[model samples]
Structures are given as structure tokens and as C-alpha cells.
Target: MNQTAPATLRSRLWWPSAAALTIAAAALGATLLLPRLFSDPVGVDPYVLRLTGVAIALAFVALVWSRFATVRPILLAVAAMTAAFSVFAGGPQWIENISGSRFDFNTQVLFASAAEALLTAVVAVLAVRTSPSTLRPLLRLRRFGPTALIATIVGVAVFVAVVMLLPATLLGREGIAPVALARDLPLQGPASVLQSFAQELQFRGLILGALDRVAPPWAANLGQAAFFGLAHIAVVYQGPGAAFVPVTIVLGFVLGWVTQRTGSLWPAIVIHAVADIAVTVGVIPGLYGY
Candidate 1:
């Protein structure tokens, strides 16, 4: 008998979905915790880290496929996110090498972000050939309605409030230089916008969308938010690094909740972009570029 999936898994969403939360959490630790623990002189290569993350996620998917169907989509989404992040992280080095390191920091970041967004879209689009359902659920690229527009407006207001409320101690800025800030804005602005959109799609659309299908809304939200927060681990080298990870996790949760409510990812995308622009402009640069 070609028995189908148990109606138990489909009819109600609470148990399986809640269980999936723990799975996602474990997956996050497997993929990121090791790297964080070894963040010092024991520098793990980015390529190796990316490969290990995806391999671990997919291996978990394989292990649980027979036992826990509800988490399969969540695992796949994590794998996809890992792959895309790896590409984004490594993209700039290739760009710099090819272009002879001639581009400024902002320009290099712009190219890296663009490559990430485009490659993810292209690969997903092509994968549709083998499985038509593969691309749509994983990427909520078509969800922009009135509610999303309202959310976007709110996002801008929230951005302004955050910038105003942030203390000088956090920014470490004694005095502002209007001239240098203006000079960097042209490239920095677009770079931040593109980078924000790229990440929003990865965490909110790609991963959260997949989880939403398998888990309850709250579980799905938490799953993606955790992944999103953990994904910013590199920022430890870029900004106040370690402290920023928890903040990004919170940001990821709010954005996921916004998407869960408004049914669109643009609100998250807009707010993220404005926030990035704020961080780059306000915070002083560190060893790694913001």
C-alpha cells in the first residue's frame, strides 16, 4: 500500500511544529556554535566552515527523514542558507582578486551583496526545473501587499527612532565628520540596502517560509530568527561583534513576527537596510569592514 503521510502531521500544527523548534536550535548549534567556540587563532577556513555547516544540516535531514518529517524542510532551509552565506562571505575575495583590489570597501561590499542575491535567485530558479515546488515555498519573493506597505512605513519610523535613541557610548563617536560621511553615502547606502535585502530573503523568506510550512507560526518564527541571529557571528570581528549577535537574534525575531503578521518580507528588508546604513555611518570601523 502506498500509504501517504499521516493526517496527524497535517491536521494539527502544534506538536510537530513545537518539536521542530528544538531541532532547529540543535541545528543552529551544530552549524555555528563550533565556529564561535574556535573564533580565535584557530581560524577555520570559510570554505570549510560553509561546507561543514551544510553537510551537517543535510546529514541531519537524512537522519530524520524517516522519523521526523516535520523538520525536513527546516533542515533544508538551513542548508540553503549556509550555502548562500558561504557564497556571500567568499564572494568579495574573488571580486577583489579579479579586479586587482582596486575597489574601495563600499564598492567591494556592493559587489559581494549583489552576487549573493543574484546567485541565490538564479540557482533557485534553475532548481525549479527538477522540482517545480522547490523554489516557491522556499522563497517568498512575491508577497508585497497593502499591509506590507504599511509595515514599510512603520519600519522607516522605527529606524528614525532607533537612531535617535542610540547612545553615543554605543557608537563611540565623539564628533561627526560631515564631509567623510557624505562621501561614503553614495556607495555605502546602496551596499547596505542590497546586503539587507539579500539577508532578509535568506532568513525571513527562504528559511522562515520553509519552516512555516512544517511548523506552527511561532515555531517557524523562532527557527528562522535563531538562524538569522547566529548567521551574524562574523560581525564579532566587524563591530562590537560578540554583543551584536544577541541583538541580531532579537532583530530577526521581530522581523519574522512582522512577516508572520503582514505576509511579506519587505518590511523586514526595509528596516534592516536602514539599520545597516545607520550602523555603518554611525559606528567606527574595526578590523573587519562593517
Candidate 2:
């Protein structure tokens, strides 16, 4: 009886898994509403619709987590799609826009995209194969709910405090001037909060979460770090300093290491978001000139 209990439990989980899939599909469909509502909102760009879709998908995944654990893997797929769409819609576009260069896919960005997709797909497959239970691949994270939530909140507070009080020099910048580019800097706290969450959900929650199950801890960490580097190629192409590209890539690897070491996205999300804010708001005008 004892030996059969595990198999029995697995069998029982199957129906719930089907329901979870249905729920995920419904939720994803609902995400389309976001683009419609924001199609002409003041100061809102159509591109923001992608961010909205990610947020809505995440919300749906969280809503279904308790009753339908299988929603987790589906959520990962949704997140991956969002990332892919973002790469297509904005990633390359941002590179060209920033470089003052013409649009061309024959560059490092193409290679990075391919690499990220391959690495992420490999990690996703391994994660699914290794887990014995269905939901374990996506939802079997360490239960640090309160601690993690508190840490995330605290991290955000610290980030904001630093952004407002810490001198720009400490952030390796000069002053709060680049913020004039409202389209990029986005001077709203609420928007910043949402932005941080979207990034964490896509990068750490989905990608890293998938890797945690498949690869050994070290390999997963390194692989995701490499993906992080791929995601940031746009930043490296912003100016004449081609040499800075390697530095950005290295920093990405460090951020991935930090995410793996902590087993939580709070630290990386907080620091990365802060770094972005500092660069966009504190440096461009003060140091680099818009």
C-alpha cells in the first residue's frame, strides 16, 4: 500500500493538470484585453501592450496556482512567449534606435537571440524531464513565501531610498538629468513597480525557475547568466564604447549568479531595477548627454 500511494497520487493529479491548462488558456486570452484598453491612452505607447500582457499572464498564473498547480508550466510558456515577443518588438529596435544605426538583424543581437532561445529551451526540457511530479517542474519552489515577499518589499524600499538619496557618483554616474526622456525614464513610481515585477517574473521566475529543476545548480546558474548577457546586448550598443559590451555581459553573469545564490529574485530584481533607474535617470544627461 505504501509503495502504491505515490503512484496513486500521481494519477489523481492528472485531472487537475487538465483543468489548469484550460485555465491558463482562458487567462491568456483575457490578456488581449490589455492592448485594446491601452491602444490610445495618454502618453502610452503601443509597445507597452507587451508588458501588460506579461503582467496579466502572471496574475492569472498566481490566481490558479493553488487550485491548479499545472498552471505553473503553462505560465512559463507564457513568459517565454512574452520574452520572445519583447525581443522581436523592442530588443532589436532599441539597439537600432540607440545606436543611431539602421535596422539590421545581421549583428550580435541575432546570435544572442538564438543562443538565449536554445539555452532556455534546453533548460525547460531538462526541468520537465527530471521532475517526478507534474507541477514540480514549475511550482515546486522552496517555500519562503513570507520571507521572500518581505525581502522583495524591503529591497524595493532600499532601492528607492538609494535612488533618491545616494549621490549619483556612487552609482558610477553624475546626476539626475537623463530622466528628461520620459518615454524611457518614465517618472512614475507605480510604473516602476510594475516594470520591476514584469522583469522578475520573466527572467528569474520563469527562466531561472525552469533551469532550477533540470540542470544541476551550477550549470543552471551559468546558463541563465549567459541568457542575461544576451538580453542586454542592446545596452552595450548604446554608444561608441564597443569595449563596454563585454562589461555589460559580465555584469549580467554576476546578476544571474546572485539570483542563483539567493534562490530568490528579490536581490537581482532590486539591484537591476536600481541600476536601470540610475542609468536612465541619473546619468545620460548628467554624463553621457541625451
Candidate 3:
């Protein structure tokens, strides 16, 4: 069967993309109305609002892009980037966030891996079986094969270096804590490594791919990066009037752009994941108290 769209399932497959789009819009709407939903709010965090808002906007845009005929490549790309970000940049924080009373990187890695597998499966099914027009995206790859691979490596390297060199102050109070891996998380070493790799594939590779085709590099970068940061909503908390939202959005935009310009997610994924790992490992023992 042609991978673009299987003839038999074309009619029924429209719902997936449509559903995805709807979910995106609903998410956006909720963010706008969050104030009304919560009464006597303990403490409103602007970052929470920021994340919810961008998720909705991006989902809406993705839906609109689905209506086109020539955007399949871009859609694939977006999916890839989103998936990657969820794992690398977003996963470690997610681990920290949901740990609540019981925290372990091994557990977090397992949960994250499972989620990624599910997402990849969903996208794969849609890509192969859905109406190409229904699920298409707005970006396309100008080049592929070896060049893409090279770009991915170089991009990931540069991003990692930049993040490493970034002053600790840039992360802000409600921002991501600095962490990198020294000993690797317990028995899950192989699994953790794979999770990091998968993250780059989804976010930098997939999501950026779609956005790049539709908007200018800046726009695409900003759009996807916002989603990228928002995806970390589970991790950070901010006060009602705090500027967390704007900061996260700005950070997301920068990371997303870096991935797009390099034509690969590797750059964003490596730095993003490594940064988290470093933070997780805590300050080096030799430097200070750690």
C-alpha cells in the first residue's frame, strides 16, 4: 500500500487529525479561561498560563495545516520534534515534577519511554493509513539522507555547548534547575540513553520539520519552541503575577529556532537532555559542596 494514504481507510482517517486539532484548540481555550475555572486559587502561576496558551495555539495551527494537500512532510516533522522534546528536554523535568513523594529517574524514564512509544505509534499509523491531505503538515525537507544526519550531529553539538556555557542565572528562579548526568540513572542506563535519543527525533526532527515548511525560520522556531516549553508545564510552578510565562515562551522560541536553522533536532535534544542530566546529577563534587 502507498504510505502516503491507504485508499481504503482514507474516508475514516480524517477524525484523527481533526481530533488532534480540536484538542489543540480546547487546550488553548482553557488557558485563556483558567482564571474563571479556579476559585480562591492558591497561587496562580503565569508560566502555567503561558504553557496552556501556546499549546492551544500550536495545535490550532497544526489543524489548519492539516487541511492542505502538500504539507505531509511538515506534519511528519512537527510530530517528530514534539516527540523528541517530550523525552529529552521535557522528560527529566517531568520526572522531577511527577515524582511527588516517590522520585526515581528509572521510573520516570520508563513512563516517558512508554508515552513516546504510544505517540510514535499513533503518528506512524496516521502517516501510513490516513488521507495524506487530512494529516499533512506545512513544512518540507529541502534535503535528506546524509546531509540531514550531519546537520543533526552538528546542531546538537552546538546547542549542548551553548547550554553548558549559559550562565546559571539565565534559568531564573521558576526556571529549570541546572542538572547533568555524571553517574547515569541506576540500572536504567541503556534505557535512559535511548530515551534521550528518541526525544531529539521527535522534537527537533519531527516538529521542526513541519513548522519549517509552513512559516519563516523565525516564526517556525518561535511556534514550535513555545510548544516545546509548554510541554514542560508539569514541572515548574510560578506565582500569579510572576513573569514565568514570558520567560519560558522566550526560551522555547530560542530552542525551537536553533533546531530549525540547523535542519535537525539533535542540537536541541542533546543540549536539552544533557542540561537536565547535569542538573539531575547536581553540581560537581570537586567544584563546591554540591
TM per prediction:
0.77, 0.44, 0.49
Model 1 lDDT tens row, 1-290: 21122345444644554455456556555544466666633335654364547545563663456664444444444555556666667767777888986987668877877876776565445332232242134455677999999988987898688768878666544455688788888987997788787778767876676556545678778877876775566423233456677788888899899888887888898998988887777764521333
Off by over 4 Å in 3: 1-36, 40-105, 124-206, 234-251, 283-290
Give the 10-residue window scoring lowest on summed lDDT in candidate 2: 1-10
Candidate 3 per-residue C-alpha lDDT over 45-135 given as tens digits, one digit per residue, 9 for 90 to 100: 5333354346434534544664633344334434443443345435656778767648566666666665664565456445434424433
Give me the candidate number with maximum TM-score: 1
Clashes of 2: 0
lDDT for predicted candidate 1 compared with the true structure: 0.64
Query: Which numbered prediction scores highest in lDDT against the true structure?
Result: 1
Error of 1 at 162 (Å): 2.4
Backbone collisions counted per model = 1, 0, 33
RMSD to native for every prediction? 5.1, 14.3, 9.1
Q: Arrange candidates, best TM-score first.
A: 1, 3, 2
Cα deviation in Å at residue 240, candidate 3? 12
- Give the C-alpha miss distance for residue 185 in model 2, angstroms: 6.8
lDDT string for model 2 (1-290, tens) is 12112445545654443444345444544444344565633212544344436534663554455543434554454445444445534555667767666634434244334444554454345335433453444322344455556655665677578567867654445544343445444333333333444454445656545445444555545544554554443223344434445655565566566566555666666666666555545554454543
